[model samples]
Target: MKGQGKRSICVSLVALTFASALAACSSNSSSGTQNGTAGTAAGTTADASKEHRTLTVEVFDRGKPGQPDLNNNFWTKYINDNFGKQFNATVNFVSVPRAQEVDKLNVLMASGQAPDISFTYTQGVVYNYVQQGGLAELDSVLKQYGPTLTKYLGDDVLKYGKFNGKQFSIPGKRTVLAGSNTFIRKDWLDKLGLPVPTTPEQFYDTMVAFKEKNPGNVSGVIPYGFSLQPSNPGLNYIPEAFKPSSLTEEQFATLQPQSIWLTNWNMPGFDKAVQYMNKMYNAGLISPNFATDKDGKLLDADISNGKVGAFQTNWDGPYRTAPGTYANLAKNVPGAQLIPIDPWQNDAGKHPKNVYSPNGMYIIIPKTSKNVDLAIQYLNWMADPKVTLFLQNGQEGVDYNMVNDVPKQTGTTNSGDKMMTVANNLDYDILSNGIELGDQQKNTAAISAGYPGYEKDVENALKVGMVDSYTTYYYSLPNAADAKSNTELKNLSAQMLAKLIVAKPAEVDSLYKTLVQQYMSQGGQAVQDEYIKNYKAQNGK
Candidate 1:
C-alpha cells in the first residue's frame, strides 16, 4: 500500500475526486436490511435502517459431486463476512458446476428463485437475461456508489454491459492473451548448441535440429502443438506469429480498406505454418495421437511422457492435472521441465494474426433483490483497490506475508487453490484488470511462483495486443443470428486450415479458396457489414 493513498488521491482529483463525492453525502447507511414488515427495497431509505435480509447469489463452484462446500465453500464465508457487515444482509451462495451454471440459473430465473447476483459467460445468456426484464439498470445506483468501478472498468467496457443503451449487468472483466506462449525444453536447446529462435524459419530450424539430434528422445515430441478442439481452440495458446487474423486488423478493415485476414485462414503464412507441422508429423516430431485426444489427455500424456519438446501452452502449465496425474509424471520422468519459450523468441516480435476476445466474463443481477442500490454499493466496494487486493491476496498475515516490501502468500495456499477456498469462503470472483493492483505476487508465490513473472510478461505482451475489431455486442444481438453465422464461418475457416496443414503442400491454395467461399456464403458478408456499421457508430466514425 506504499503509494496507494497517493495514487488514489491523484486519480480521484484528476477524475472523480472520490473524497469530495463521499463527503457531499451524509454518514447515512449504505446497508441493506431484511424485510421485517414491508421493505425499503430501493436505495431511497434514510439512516436508522435495520432488518435481517439475505440476498441470494448464483455462482460456479469447483467441487466434487454432492459436496456441500461446492455451493457454500470457505471463500463464500469470507465474502459474506465483509458484505454482511457492510450491507446488514446475508449474501447467499448458490452453486452450480461450470457445465450446468447457465442452465441452472436459467431454471432459477424461470422459477423466480434467481439469486440477486449471478455470473455467466456467453453474450447470449447476458442478453437473454436482459430481454426477460430480469435485470436492473444500475445507472443511478452506479452513479451514486461506483466511482472505483467507473474509473477502473472504463467507459466502453462498461457500455458493453449494456443492452440497447441501458446497463443490465455488471461487466465481469477477464484477462486475455493472444495464445499461450510456446514453451520449449531449454535444456535440449543448449545441448543441441542452438540459440533460441527469433523467427518462424528459425523456430522450424530449431525444432528440426532437436528432432535430428535427439533422435528417439524427441521422436514423439511435438515441435509445434496445441489443443485444437472445435469448442474452445485453447484460445490463449495461439502463436503471436499468426498475427494476420488479429482483432485489430479486423477493426482496421472495418474502417479502412484491408484484405479479409482471419476469414481467409489459408494464407501463405498459415500454409507455411501447417507445412512446418506436417514436417513434424511425418518426421515423427509430434505426438502420434494429437488430433484424436481430448485437451486434457493430450497435455497430460505429452508433458508427463517427456515427449513434448516444444508446445503452445499456458505459463501455469499442467500443474492442475487430476489427482495422481502430475505426480505420476514426476515419478516416471524427473528431468522433463517446461521452459517458457516466448513466442517472440520464435518469431521475434512477428505476431501472428488473431483477435482479442472480449475482456470480461458474464454477470447477472436478479430482479428479486430487495435493495439494488445496496447490492451495487457492495459490488462497487469490490472495485475498490483495497478490497480487490484483499480478495486477491487475502487478509494480511492470514493468507500472505510481506517480504522485501512485496506481499507473498504463506502455507499450503496458492492463487488457484486459494481462489477455490476464497470463493467458497469469501464469496469472491475474478476480474480482468487489476491483476497487478491486487497482491498478485503474494497470491502467485504460494502456488506456482511462476505466476508473478508470468503476470508481468503478459502485461508487457499487451502493449502489442490487438483489441478485437468486432464488438462483443455483435455476439449479443437479438437472436444472436449474426454470431451464429460468424461461428459457422470461423469453424469453416479452422477446418480448412487444419486440412491444409495435414494435406499435401500443393493442395493448400485450393482448399483455402474453398474455405473463403464457404465464409462468404455463411453470412460472413452480412457479419462484416453489421460489424463495420456498428463499429463506426460506436466509435463515432
Candidate 2:
C-alpha cells in the first residue's frame, strides 16, 4: 500500500512531464528501432524535438549461459512496451562486454559513437571526457525533462554527476553502501570450540587454528580467501584495517582512492598490513595461489568447496544463487554453517572499511546523442517506485508473493514472465542498484525473505558489513594525475602487494620501503601532492 501510493504519485508525475514535453515539440523525424546493436552518432538539436527516434542504451553483456539476450529479453521488451511506447521512441540496447567495458566504451566514445545512454563505474573516465568537452551538460535538460529523476536521485547522488557547476551525468543510487563483508564457517568454529573472532589478532589466531586443526576436515583448507585482481584488488578486505587511527582527513583525501588505491598500499600502516599478510602466507593460512585468482572466481570455488575458513567480499557475495557459493556449499558439505562476521578491527578498535558513496555506475548521456530528453525520461521511468518494484520483484503471485510488506521471490519458471538470473537484473535497473523498498526495515525484511534457506544469514551479513562502514573521499573536481596514471598505479600497487604478501617476514619492511619509493617516484607523489592541494583549497582546512 505504501509502495502503491508512492508509485501512483510518481507515475502521475512521469505522465504529466511527458505530456508537457510532447505538446511543445517542433518536429517528429522518425528512425526505426535498432535492437541490441551498437550506437551510432545522432544530431542533438533538431532531432531532439518530438521525434520517433531510435534511442540506443548501453547494457553489459557478461555472455552468461541460459540468460536472455541483453537486447531482446522479456525485460528489454517490457522496457520498450512501457517507456519506449510512452515516448514514441524505439529503444535499442547496445551490448558492452562486462570484462572489457571501459575499453569497449572508449573505442565507441573516441569515434563519437557511444550509446545514447551509457555508464561506467570509473569516474576518472567520465572526468576525462568532461575535461575534453565530450559530454553534454544536463542541468537545463534535466530540469525540463527529468523532474522525477532529480527528486529520486536528489542532490546527494546527483552531485557525483555534476562537473564544473553543470550536471553531466546521473549517478545510479546504491541502497546499501557497505563495501566488504566477511563470512566465516560457523560449523568449523563450533567444531574447534572457538568463538567468532572479534579482533585482528584473534582473527589471526583463529586462522592459525583453522590451518593446524583442519576443523572442516577438508584437505588444503584455506584459512583466508584472497584475490589479486590487477584492476580490482579490493582494499576493504585487507590492508584498510591497518589504516592508522590517527589518519587525518588530509591524509585520507591524498590516498588516491577513486581507482588505484584498491590495495590501500598508501595507508599509513600499510607495511604492517603487508607484514601481517606475509605472516599468513608463511603459515599457509591463506590461499596458496591467490595471485592467480583474478576476477575472484577461483576464490569462489574454494568457498563453495568448503575449503575456505573466512573471506571478505561485496556484502552479498555468498548469497547469490548463480556461482551460488552458499547454496553450493550447503549441497557439497552438509551442515556448512557460513555466517557473516566482523572480526578484522582497525587500530581504533573500529571495523573501518570503505563503503560505496550511495552511488554505483555513473550514468551519462554523451554529447553525440539527440535523445537527451528521451534519455532523461527513460531514466525517470525506471526511477518510478512502481517500475522499480516490478523490475526487481516482478508480478505478484507469478515471480513472487507478498508475505508481509516485502515481495519474496517464488518460482520464476514461466519463460514469458521469468526474471533475469542476475540478482535483480541490476544491469537494466540503470538508475538504482540493490533493493530499496522505501524503508530500512522493509529492505532488510525483503533481503531476508528473498534468499529462503540463508535468509537470516544474508540479512546479518548486510547489517554487519554496514556497522563501521564509511564512504571514501569524494572530490567534486577530477585529478589530472589520477586520470593519467590510475591504471598504471593500480596495476603496480596490486603487483607490489601480491609480491609483498609472499615475501619472507623479515624482508617485508625493507621490501615495502623499496616499493613505496618506487611507487612515489612513478607519479604517485604527483597524485598525492595534487590531491592534498585540492583538499586544502576545497575544505579551507
Query: What TM-score would each prediction reach against the true structure?
Result: 0.71, 0.80
lDDT of 2: 0.73
Q: Which candidate is the best by lDDT?
A: 2
| Best-matching candidate per TM-score | 2
Give, for candidate 1, the lowest lDDT window spanning 10 residues. Answer: 1-10
Q: Give the TM-score of candidate 1.
A: 0.71
Tens digit of per-residue lDDT, candidate 1, span 1-541: 0000010000000111111110111111222232111122233232327775666566566553343443344445555556565567666656666667666766666666666666765566666667656677778778876676666677756766877778787775543323234566666777777787756667777777766777226445565554454433222323234534434644444432212222223232444455555655666656566555544466666666666667654333433334333345556666544455544322334443333344455566666566676666657656665556566556677676666545566643443434434321233654443243445444333333324434453443333333222222232233343445645554565565456556665665676567657766776566557656666665557
lDDT of each: 0.50, 0.73
What total of clashing residue pairs does each candidate reach? 44, 0
Off by over 4 Å in 2: 1-56, 61-81, 84-115, 218-221, 234-236, 256-261, 292-307, 410-421, 536-541
Worst 10 residues of 2 by lDDT: 1-10
**Candidate 1 deviant stretches above 4 angstroms:** 1-46, 50-52, 65-81, 175-179, 215-222, 233-285, 318-336, 343-349, 352-358, 385-400, 404-427, 430-479, 482-495, 519-530
